[model samples]
Target: MPGAVLAPTSAPGYPAHVRIHEVGPRDGLQNEPATLPPDVKAEFIHRLAAAGLTTIEATSFVHPRWVPQLADAEQVFPLVRDLTGVRLPVLVPNERGLERALAHGAREVAVFASATESFARANLNRTVDESLTMFTPVVARSLDAGVPVRGYLSMCFGDPWEGDVPVTQVVRVARRLSDLGCAELSLGDTIGVATPGRVAELLNALAAAGIPADRLAVHFHDTYGQALANTLTALRHGVTTVDASAGGLGGCPYAKSATGNLATEDLLWMLNGLGISTGVDLERLVATSLWLARRLGRPSPSRTVRALSHQEPRE
Candidate 1:
């Protein structure tokens, strides 16, 4: 088991202790061109936990045909199954994926649904409604097995093919996921086109629909450089959970126009500056991202990582 320690603190317009759901191992690496071995993936989780990330998304149980990078979920889960103080949630697109995750004694699982018809078709080969319908049983069986489920709704702000996605449409899909027993729902701005105002509007709508801010998580991309700003807006609305990838290592393979997710280091930098406690050690977290960046044969895309790497050493 890795270390689980954090310097306690708080931030403005945010919860005293925000839950940073580290999605680097799964969501972050899944889009990388190179396929990281299961052992490497497990080590990444261990490093993240050592850096004090409590909820690390470990892997996806979706078929290799879809996400070949995480095809080794079975092998990956066993290596980090005993890590203390960390929640390893695997993504399961359907019942078959759920069964695979459960076979490995998974305690938490996530299902992804798209908010727009275009993204739904591009990513899942189904309509948005159909994707949600498919996840109903997946969520039900996971809950029945006593495994808490997290739901991801992508393209909540805008879609490349469809143009602007109305807030009403996003709320509708969100409500369905809430009704389906997802303990938490992560709203994704898949294309990084969302502004802070739009984020606030969406959260407001979800709140009005009986979904509390605590039940929602925000996942933003830095495409238009709005991820951090949108995240701050979400925090102001009382969204405590946020999804970020270490080293900023992900882009939507289905959405070619999309960029990488908000970097965990960048998010941590903001949280730390605001005195928001995420239970994550900023310096150690940057080191972990630097290590992973070496394995991928590229410099990290995170601004904080770049800045820190170039800073003059203190005596």
Candidate 2:
């Protein structure tokens, strides 16, 4: 029942406002071992909206065989689709996935791509070029339908199979997605091995390739506890959009070594201290994560959630 304490002073030169692209429903739940019922998933999203998260990744349109946890995307989406002033984006792996999302009235969609051939093969069963080929039409068609598409470039920092990824390689794939009409790209540190300097390298290289910071989002995992450092580096360089999951509930099923996405509450706590507006109620968000932790049968991995919820978060 305790609340979060904001930082006493402000930091300099960070974005005045950051758009937290909430991925708790889709990315967070997809990696869970338990498959929550559609209604529970919808309620989770509703809580996030009530906590003032404007952009939420609701679900994925990928085949059920790929991610069984999110198989009920169709049924879960409608429950929160009518929420006002919220942008719900769904993950669409390919054209078929896009079709599924469209049929269910999805207004925003995202395509997942890998920066290395190893991840492209393991995650999507395609080579790097082949996966891009698959996404080309998906992006084009989504734009044609007036639905904005977000491109997820996973393994931007390091890959378990391929080791460190070169900045140029990421920029190349990112430019391809951007050229295909993706309105934004979420650069992912899939294995959470990114250092602040490496993050700076990629962002700089992408800028050199004509990909602006405004059109880029940073998605980092916490395997090495570097997600926050990597994210701040991106923010310092003028990137405003960040992808985070509630309660730090996520890991890549395809890449076993990966950890949870950056915790939304943890990120909110830092931004609040820095005086960067995110429009999220930290008290409500801590409460929401505590609400979900009970459902997941474990305490949240997020430091802020645990600290604010008084460790147990139950009276």
What's the count of clashing pairs in each model shown? 1, 0
Writing each residue's lDDT as its tens digit, candidate 2 over 107-199 gives: 999999999999999999999899999998998899899999999999998999999998888999999999989899999999899999999
TM-score for each prediction?
Answer: 0.94, 0.97
Q: Where's the lowest-lDDT run of ten residues in candidate 2?
A: 1-10
lDDT of 1 by residue, 198-226 (tens): 99889988999999999999999999999
Q: What is the C-alpha local distance difference test score of each model?
A: 0.89, 0.91
Model 1 misplaced regions, further than 4 Å: 1-12, 310-315
List where candidate 2 sits over 4 angstroms from the true fold. Answer: 1-3, 311-315
Candidate 2 global TM-score = 0.97
Instruction: Please report the candidate that would top lDDT against the real structure.
Output: 2
